[model samples]
Target chain A: MKLGIDAMSGDLGSAIVVEACRSFLSKNKTDELYVVGKKEELLALESYSQVTIIDAQEVLEMTENILAIRRKKESSMVKTMMLAKNDEVDAVLSCGNTGAYYASAMLFLKRLEGIEKSCLMAMLPTYNDRGVALLDVGANSENTAEQLKSFAIMGSVYAKNVRKVSNPKVALLNIGAEHHKGDEVHQETYKLLESMQEINFIGNIEGKEILDGDVDVVVTDGFTGNVALKTIEGVAKVLVKSLKDGFMSSTRTKVGAVMAKPALKQLMNKFDTKAAGGALMIGFVKPVIKAHGSSDAIAFENAMNLAFDMVSSNVVDKMKEGLK
Target chain B: MKLGIDAMSGDLGSAIVVEACRSFLSKNKTDELYVVGKKEELLALESYSQVTIIDAQEVLEMTENILAIRRKKESSMVKTMMLAKNDEVDAVLSCGNTGAYYASAMLFLKRLEGIEKSCLMAMLPTYNDRGVALLDVGANSENTAEQLKSFAIMGSVYAKNVRKVSNPKVALLNIGAEHHKGDEVHQETYKLLESMQEINFIGNIEGKEILDGDVDVVVTDGFTGNVALKTIEGVAKVLVKSLKDGFMSSTRTKVGAVMAKPALKQLMNKFDTKAAGGALMIGFVKPVIKAHGSSDAIAFENAMNLAFDMVSSNVVDKMKEGLK
Candidate 1:
């Protein structure tokens, strides 16, 4: 398998991407990596026989507009995507501005034949030790009922192939679990999902039930999905901060925190977002993955493994079949 | 002040309501309580001079349709709302079906002039220990830009009068902080809020920032607001449960858990929803508070205190002035 990595755009510099590529190459000797970035920064990866340096002088800023993707054709992000468009790589990974990355993918790779709109799909950890696939987390600010229907099909395909879930149960995320809940778009999407035979449709799931591990795939518009996902992250951060402050208030609790270090570390790992690697941009002709902006070496390596798994499992091909 | 309580509709039964009334009336001798429910169940309150046991044989089920408010006029929820409508009580409180309670409040007390729709407003805990008022939590499944404008006015008045903020900073709850983000309704609402000189408009706030205590009031359509509120609660529950399981995994961790109990308890109290009392049904002529369905005596009493505070603060009059 061959992969293209945009080494300059992440919050952490290209040095970590170099380190991740080295670690990944150490494990998978059969895979080829095309590391795209400034020549001087990525020169460290040249020692590995399986790694090739693809020089792109420009770097996209984190707050760059989506239109910047069209203007900055020589940037690493656009160059990496162009490789996927040309069939030079099976998949491409970047941790750049999400809006810019998505726009670049649409411009270079285009959408699948039967897909109306492309979406970002991420795997979230659940209490049952399994991950649930959530789609349209931030692809489009708004979506039509037909667009949400396409997201369901794409999400189900991802769960089946990449996550290895058989006959995934897809649900609409709304305010209530009842059939007659949510707005006009959601109500119409419910009918579309219920009538389709391509996926196993669960009636509806609320935001609170997303992490309960009851459903394999949850679908919603990008606006609501983005807000809900971030709200969970925000609450977790607040809780962890509060706990740290409480533990340090007195010597007795400080000693207890020392003894509970291992257990707490295990618990943090259980809820870690890094374990899920990164979000996949589905409904495109070629696979595109978006690593978290703050990814370190280990997280970036996990994202690379995800790209390899998607290509090996033929996820995009299966998605095309599901859409048809 | 006179307060009406719906004793039969809560999930915890009338016993907790009775206990709450006793505890409330013990300190608030000047306030009158008109507890409406099955007379036999509420006979314990008859001994107090401040308590009046009003009989209503029927109980509204939690899953009952909103139209049941019209059909079940003799039910405790309707009777309690009727007391407020007749000016026999200054305010009403219920721990009942949210839909039925809102429907009954609209049917009985009616919306204040210039108010297009009534909405549920909730007080959420923030990291800074102050509270933020979130409006349209679950009143209308969908809303128009104009309706959201009304929600902003009502929520601002609530923050000023009920929450006691001097000059409230009002923001529209959205997926992004940008001026051009979100769907059509939110974009229109942003313009409306920006043009209005009455509110201290602070542009848009995302779900993650709702608990940061930077804004005093956040307004949105009911569907998104409900989903966001519940998502915060869900994540908090999952984290607490995981912490419990981790601490119980081994002997050393169990010892640490014993020493960490006080700190953990303090953290829990800091994030507790019960301290906010309950959600107020705003945009009506009178105040209508809905307690959590599973409220115990302490939570129910907090809701009662909320009712007392709203009536005493002349929140309804100020809301009418703000709307004008």
Candidate 2:
């Protein structure tokens, strides 16, 4: 499998991306990598037989607008997608500007024949130990009933093909479980989802239900999905931090903390998004994996694991057939 | 202050509501209670001079539609709102159907003159130990930019008057902190809020910023707000449960658990929504507190504590004056 990495983006900069790719390539000798970034920076790195450096003149900063993809045609993120578009690489991965990466994928790879827009599908940890696949985490802020239906179909395919879930239970994200919940758009989307037979539509699910682990896939528009994802992350961070601080408060608590450290670490791992690797930019002609902006080398490697799986499983083709 | 209690509603019925009122009235000697429910079921309670029993013939179930408020005109929830509307009670509290309560309040309270809709404002726990107030948590699923502006104004006033955060930093909730984030509704809401002089608009805040305790009030449409609220609640529950289960795994851990119990309790208390009491149904003519549906008598009493504060501080009148 061949994977392209956008090294000039994200919070940690190019060095972490390079190190992560080098680490992955060293172990997975069979896979090849095309590291896309500035020529001077990338060429200075130690060479490996499986790695090829692709230099793009410009870099898309996190602060730049997504329109920078079109304006800066030679940007690393756009160039990486171009390689995937040309079939030079099976998939691409990024820890860069989320919006720019999304825009570049849409511009270069475009959507599949039947898909209107692509969704960012994230694997969220649930209490039941079965991860839930949530779509449109921040791809499109506003979505129509038709767009939502497309998200359901795409999410289901990703769950079944990539995540290896059979007959994935797909639920529309809403405030209430009622079919008539949310606005007119949601009501229509609920009806559309309920009528679908190919996908295992489980009616409506709320934010609380996302972590319950009952449903395999949860689908919603970008705005609500983004809000829900961030809220979960924020709360988890606060809880974990608070727990750690409380454990270190005094000597008595520190002893207790030592005894409880293993248990606490296990619990924290269950809710870790990085453990799921990265969110997939689904509905494109080719797969694009978006690692977290602050991802470490381990997280990037895990994301590459997901990318390799997506390539091997032929998720793009399966999605095309499913939507058809 | 005469507070109306919807006794014939919520997970636990009239008995819990009656007990909660009794508990609140016992210590809060200055406050009076109007318990609205079926005359037969409520007459069984030991009467106090400060408490009055108001008979209602019907009840609105959680599964029923919000329209049931008009259909079941004699229901406990509706009757309680009517009392507030007629100035028969200073405030109202319900641990019942959120939609039904919102409907009845809108019908009776009539949105405080210039207000287009009332909001459900929740106090969410943050890492800073000072919780942030989130508005429109499930009241208006789809909202206009104007309505969002009104929410910011009302939320700011509530934070200032009730929560006692002078010059509260109000923020528009969006996917990103950028000037142009989220959908068009949110983008327009940001500009409107920024232009408003009455509220201290802090620009756009992401979901993660909510629990950071940086912002005083976070405003969003009901759909996003509700999802975020439930997501936080779900994660908190899961984390607390996981921590408890971890503590019970072995003898060494059990001993540590005993030692850490007090510190853990303090950390959990920081995220406890019940201690902050219930969400205030703001932007109404009078305060309408919506306690959690599964709340016990203690939680309900805490909600009444919030109601008593809102009434005493003239939150509604201050909101009306501020908006005007």
Candidate 3:
């Protein structure tokens, strides 16, 4: 398998991407990587026979406008998408501005044949340890009932193939678990999902139940999904900060923190979003993974591994067949 | 101040409400409480001089239909709302079915004059401990831009008078921080909030920033607001559970848990939703506070105290002036 890695544009810069490429190639000798960035910055990966450095003249800034992807065709993010478009790589990975990468994917690889609107899907950690697939995290601000139905189909396919959940139980995220709970579009989408025979529709699931790990797939419009996803991240961050503050407040607690470091590390790993890897732009023709903006070397390498898994599992092809 | 308490419908039953009323009356000598419930269930409050037990034959189940409030007029929730409607009580508090309580408040107390829609406003704990007020948390499944504008005005009044934040800053909760993000109604609401001279309209706030304690009040449509609020609760619960599991995994960690218990307790208190009290049914003619259905004695008492504060601060009257 071959992967295209955008070596610039992440918050940590190209050094982490180069390190990630080095680590990933060391583990998977059969897989090849096309690392796109300034040639001088990625010199560290030059020794690896499986890695090819493609120099790009420009780098996309984190806050650059999405339309800049068109103007800066030589930028790492745009160039990596081009590699995927030309079939030089089976999958593409980036830790850049989400908007620019999403736009560039649409401009180059395009959507699957039956897909109307593409969505960003994230795997959120759940209590039971089997993560749940949540779709339309921030692809489109507003989605039609039919568009949500499409998300349900694609989410089911991704959960079944990538997450390996057989006969995935799909649900619509709403204010209440009742069918009549949300807005007009959601209420209409409920009927559409319930009538579908190809997927296991479990009616509605509330936001509070999303992390309970009861269902395999949860679907919503990009707006609400984005809010839910970020809210989870915010709460986790604040709590962890508070916990550290608590542990450091006094001599006794500081001692306790030292004693419990191993257990605490295990707990953090259980809830770490980085371990779950990047979000997948599911409706595209090839797998497109968006690593977190603040990804470290390990997180970025995990994203590449996710891209490889998507390619190996034939997720995009299965999603196309499911949509049909 | 005079307050009405619905004693029968909470998840913990009338015992906790009776205990809460006892604690409240003991602390507040001048205040009177009209506790509404079954006569047999609320006999424990008969000894207090400031407590009046109103006999209600029925209880609203947690899953009861919203329209049931009209039919079960003798239900404790409906009877409590009637106390506020008839001016027999300055404020009303309930830990019953949220839908039933909200509907009863609308049917009895009615919306304040000139208010287009009433919103449920929750006080979420923030890092700074000042907390942020999030509005329209499930009052209406959908809202017009005008309705969101009204929420901004009312939320500002709430923060200033009830929360005691002078010159409070209000923000619109959107998927992104950009002024042009979110659905069409939110885009129009952004312009409306920006033009409002009475409010300190801070452009847009994302879900991730809600708990950062940067803004005083955040407004959103009911559906999105509800999702965000519950998502916060869900993540916090899951993390705390995981932390407990981690601490209990080994004997060394168990010793650490004992040593860290005090500091951890302090941290938990800082983020406790109970300490912040209940969600207020804003835009009503009088303050109508809905305590958590799963509230304990302390949470129930806190809700009553919140109603007392709302009534004492004259939040409803000040909201009317702001809307005018």
Candidate 4:
């Protein structure tokens, strides 16, 4: 297996991607990884001799127009995606701006057969000590009922094959759990899911139910998912701040904070971006993983590993089958 | 001003309503308090001697048929709302089932003119050490673009009058802040808001930007708001749990939890539902406060004080002028 890595995409420049690729290459030989970026940056990696380097001089700035994905063929991110598009690589990974990667994935790589729209899938931790694989987190915020049902099918395949959750309970995330609840699109989608036999369709799951581990695959349009994803992040920040303030309110508590630093740091790390790789865009022929732009080496490594597993699992095959 | 409180509502029954009313009567000469519920229950209040008793024989059981709000006219919640409609009371307070309260409010108190939909507004703490007010939390999971605009208007007015901010900044929540970013509805809504000269519309706001305190009013449809709201709740719960677990992980940390107990308790109390009181449904001609179903005495008192402020500030009068 071969993989394409856009080693120029994250907010940390080459530090994260270079180190992650170098560290990851140390452990793996079954996969031939191609690092696509500036030739100078590629040479900086001691692991450059161990793997292939595709010199793409184009720089895709984070704040650049998303259409740059099309305009900049020599761009590392775009070229990396192109490698997978032409089947030169099995997967492509990026820690770049999500919109740019998304643009290139569809514009260059194209969607898999039988998939109407690709979804940005995220693995969100559950309150129940598990994970719910969700779709369209920021890809297609506005969706028809048919598009939603399609998302459910795509999400289920990804969860079962990659996440390895058998029978992967699929649910449409709605405002309410009742079959009759939600907007017109959701209500109609509920009816469609209720009639479908291809996936293990569960009833509507509410946002409050996401972390509850009620469903393995939660489907929603991108807008709600993005807002929800951000809201979760925002609230987490608030709570953590509250906790920090709580721990340092007085002299004794400040001392307590010192004694508890290790454990508290460990807990806070769980919410760190580096621990959870960026979202995955599902329903593509080649596995495409996105590391958070603010990701550290751990996140970049995590994205590569996640992409490795995704490509190996043949999740796309199931998606194609389910699409039919 | 006359206020009717459902004595049977709330987790902690008539005692809170009695105390709040007792406090109200003692402080003001131009006040009438009506305890609307089972007379037998009202008798449980020590301060019951100062209030009028209106018999409402029926009770809408929580977690049961939510439509029971419409079915039982004699129910305590329905009676109180009807009292508000008939001018028998200036406002109605309930700590009962939310669905039941909504049904009664729509059936009896009626919608304010030019206000086709009402919203559940909550004050969320911002990263900047201030609060940002968001509306349509879950009142109507599905809403028209016009209704969303109305929420923005109402939210702005409420923030100005109740929160005492001038020239309140208003923003339409979207997947992106860019023009024409989201689906059909949001694109159109964006145009509509941008054209509304009367509103201090600052353009679109993404979810992560919510707690930045850049905008005073964040308006979105209830479905998304509800989802975001619950997601925030879920994340907060997880973070708090993680913090607690972190503190208890080591023996030294276990001792820290005790030393940190006082400050932690104070911080937790600040985040308590009691401090915030219940969700407030703004846009009524008079203040209609919804105390939490599980509210304790402290929470009930908080709701009552909020209600007093709502009236004293005359949020209705301001809405009447701004909305028109």
Ten-residue region with minimum lDDT total, candidate 3 chain B? B105-114
- Compose the digit string of candidate 4's lDDT tens values, residues A85-110: 78899888988888999988888777
Model 2: residue B247 alpha-carbon error in angstroms: 3.2
lDDT of each: 0.90, 0.86, 0.91, 0.79
Tens-place lDDT per residue, model 3, A1-324, is 889999998999998998888888788989889999999998888888898889997999998999999899999999999999999999999999999999999888878987889999999889889999999999999999999998999899888887888899999999998888899999999999989999999999888888999999999999999999999989888888988998999999999888888778988899888789988898889999999899999999889888988899999898889888
- What is the C-alpha lDDT profile of model 2 across B1-324, one tens digit per residue? 888889888888878787887777678777788989988887755468888888997989988888889889899899999998898998999999987898888788867877887788898878887789998898878999999988998888888988889899999889988878888998898888888889899888888778999999999999999999988888888777877787788787788788777679879777778777888888878888999888888988888888889999998899889888
Candidate with more favorable, higher lDDT: 3 or 4: 3
lDDT of 2 by residue, A1-324 (tens): 889888888788887787788778777878888989987776645478788888887888888978888888888888898899898999999988888888888878868988887888889888878899888898888999999999999889888988899999999999988898999999999988888889999889888878888999899999999988988888888888888888788888888788777677778777778878878888888889999888888888899989999999998898898888
Instruction: Give the Å error, residue B175, model 3.
Output: 1.6
RMSD of 4: 2.2
Q: What ranking emerges by TM-score with the best candidate at the front?
A: 1, 3, 4, 2
Question: lDDT for model 4, on a 0 to 1 scale?
Answer: 0.79
Clash pairs detected, candidate 4:
A141-A222, A141-A223, B10-B95
lDDT of 4 at A46: 41
Measured by DockQ, the strongest candidate is 3
Clashing pairs in 3: none
Stretches of candidate 2 exceeding 4 Å from the true structure: A7-29, A37-48, A55-76, B8-23, B26-28, B37-47, B55-75
Separate DockQ for every predicted complex: 0.76, 0.71, 0.81, 0.64
The sequence of per-residue lDDT tens digits that candidate 3 reaches over residues B1-324 is: 899999999899999998998888788899899999999988888988898889999999998889999899899999999899999999999999998899888888778888989989999999878899999998899999999999999999999998889999999999887889999999999999999899999899888999999999999999999999889889988888888898999999989888888778988999988778889999988999999999999999999888988999999999999998
Interface RMSD of each: 1.0, 1.1, 0.9, 2.0
Best by lDDT: 3
Best by TM-score: 1
